[model samples]
Target: MNMIDPWGSSIIDYDKLTEQFGIKPFTDVVDDIPHASKLMTRGIIFGQRDYNKITDALNNNKPFATMTGMMPSGKMHIGHKMVVDQLKWYQEKNADIYVSIADMEAYAARGISKEKSRELALNEYITNYIALGLDVTRDNFHLYLQSENDDVKNLAYIIGKKVTFNQMRSIYGFNNSTNIAHIYTPLLQVADILHPQLKKYGGPKPVIVPVGPDQDPHIRLTRDLASKFNEEYGFIEPSATFHRFMTGLTGEKMSSSKPKSAIYLTDSLKDAVKKVKSAKTGGRESLKEQKELGGMPDKCSIYELLVYHLIDDDKKLEEIRSKCLSGEILCGNCKGCASELITDMFEELDQKREEARKIANTLLK
Candidate 1:
């Protein structure tokens, strides 16, 4: 029962999507991919399609690529951080990393100017990407905007011929209200996913797309295209791993437009702390009631913060969860602790972001 839209974000029920959509659970292939990420181990990366190809490539010592696109409509937030964290993992494994700035998408979807989109892509998103530990110096690493990439544009035209409006409508839930360019953006995205397999990029190798489940429609389409493109399925269907979304402070969807709902990486230390304090929790109405009835960590945004971003160690996260469920940790105290953890992370990232700024031109195309 997950509601997914590439143009919009929603809180997804990961388990429901897995059952209904036939997306294999990560645990099914965990032992196959060496050095599986904590996200994979902890169910943050809950689902996958053709991830076995990546494991095959790794074990065979064959080259593989990883690509993820960013729409530069707002400041990079914790939700976006999750993707970059996965990118770092792939980079460490020596996967050729390709990051795309979806400027054309921001324009069609949000009516953002190309100039503004480009600015946000570099100054905001890419900076945070490097700050979060993505390896940009590698020879195979490439960062480019959809508008400036001729190879992707050309590939989109080729891929578009293989798809029809009927298919788009079915997969994307599009109709009369959708703009023509918006409808066409999916082909561009399919090209983004498939182009890494093109002869120039490194012919027909496996590629991994680490994303939130909201973007799976694009993956579904691209995978379908990969099989149909050639007699031998010349392009490898790009594999995908899905993560759950981080909810807003008030328990709504974490949206860039709703500043109070998310903690942006660019947020000042004081503001980030305030956001943590204001976040929603699923505890009882009163501290006394919490102790009597125990807390609902399953429904708390604070707990999600630890699971998705703030905390790293499994033992530490379990300890926090146990304390909450036993009513030994209350909302006020939990918020304070989360605030400190978030503050420290942001302070370090903000500084690294400054360092990242120095290499913007070096990375951007």
Candidate 2:
């Protein structure tokens, strides 16, 4: 049995997740989407469940929504930017955007105080979200702290009525020793996902959650709960798109808690460039060996930085990949390019975050 701990930062085997967990490949429906994001086109979004609903809504110009949450336990990192990118794409499609700050979960799992969670959510997460061009001020964008949302809290209690402790244990690998708060927090997530379909928000419509593979357990539980309560709430089972986690600078899973493994959105431009330059690469041991065997872009963290964030044009991206694989571009050259790109990006973010901080301060009020 493959146990996926939502709170754990271990690496995930995405193939096993799809084959054993019934997540359909995103490529199966890629051509169906209109103006799919680069993440989708580049195959970063690997698996999905019921994404056809979203594609249908996109094609027909019907109402739909995109929902995602942030657990404000640490600084926001570059890996977290992928979620923002997906949300931005949904916004462009005119889908209602729901951003939930999971203060309750942060408290339950990480022992973070509600006040501290709120502070981090606004200053670290939301500020960087705006800096990344999420347009939080848009009329269709709904940002709320979970602890403050009475509707979500109330719905979570009601959701708990239908779920048993045994079910939670089975899905989350919970045991007798697990804290009750930690065990119950996932119900709040279900509420976060389904609350957008409430009558006050709008009648039931398609909703999509973009997440990493580790979050599949939540997606599965939410979908089941949505069906069990469908008669009362008219809930449409939420859809999800699972994206690959960004490779860390040291080639492990990128985690905010591991400062060396990730580049925080708030990092100084010099530090950001330094991290890129020092990142692991898939280069051969020597120039002579590299010329004979070629570089492996697939295993290079610096190459992943370009593919995932820096480069946008497919043709240009392909050229870089081809050069790397053909031994024409060495690790030093790739690192130089990645470092320049990250430096430019951080400089822009530095300016935008000042105004974003002001806007973020007012968002939760």
Candidate 3:
């Protein structure tokens, strides 16, 4: 099994993960999803757990909630944009949206102050979310900070009752050095994922959580614990969609703490282009060999940017992939294309981020 740690960095083996986690392939339902998002069409949104509930909600026009959160640790990169993209899709489907700002987790785990957490949550993260086309407008959306929401905190304390320290130790790989807050966080997330199903908010409807595969452990824990909630409070068991992690430009797991590994949405165009040019590629050592043997798009970070972020058109992505596989696209040329796309994207997002910051308060509950 790939070492998947929600708090730690890992380059996962998605195949082994799908099989082990019992996640159904997203392709199985692609034909049914109405105008499937680019990520789902591209298979980046790869796996699912009991997604029929979401499909039922979509098809039958039933009430379902889309729930996920950000921890406000730092500036969000394009990797974080994956979740925002899906959030927008679910929002368009009229699913009620709930976002949690994990100020408590950031403070407890990373020693980030509440002041800094609020800054990052609003200016850095939430503004970027608004910039990403998520309709954060009233009526449908709500945002809460973990440290601020008394109900969420109380729910966390209540849910903590069913989870054992030994269970936490095994699921999170918590050692003797792990603090109580760190142990409590998975339980906190369980509350975050399930709270939308509480009676006050329409009661026991299906909820969909879109997350990176690293967070699967929390989903599994939530699944088990939600049954306890169901028996008492009528909380619905949650369903989740998993996407692959975006490998860093330097060729590893993308991390917020490692600045060079990612291209922040707020980065200047020059810095973003520089990061792209420095990215790892699957090209041969020489132009001669690359032209003869072709490139490996699967291992190339720049190519992944085209597939996962930059190029939304399936036809355009396919053209790039075919050229790379057939030696027509050299690493230099491919990186240039990716850099151009990324630079243009950063310029647009920078403007939107500024605009988003202006009305971002309206988005928050």
Query: Which candidate comes out best when scored by lDDT?
Result: 2
Candidate whose TM-score is highest: 2
TM-score of each: 0.96, 0.99, 0.96
Better of 1 and 3 by lDDT: 3
Q: After superposition, how far is residue 155 of candidate 2 from its true place, in Å?
A: 0.8
Instruction: Evaluate residue 14 in candidate 3 and report its C-alpha lDDT on the 0 to 100 scale.
Output: 85
Give candidate 2 regions above 4 Å deviation.
Answer: none
Worst 10 residues of 3 by lDDT: 356-365
| lDDT for each candidate structure | 0.86, 0.93, 0.86
Pairs of colliding residues, candidate 1: none
**Which residue segments of model 1 deviate by more than 4 Å?**
1-3
lDDT of 1 by residue, 230-348 (tens): 56438877899888788788898888888989998889899999889989998999889999888998889998998888888999989988999999889887898899899889889
Q: Per-residue lDDT of 225-294 in model 2, one digit per residue for the tens?
A: 9999999989999999999999999999999989999999999888888899889999999999898889
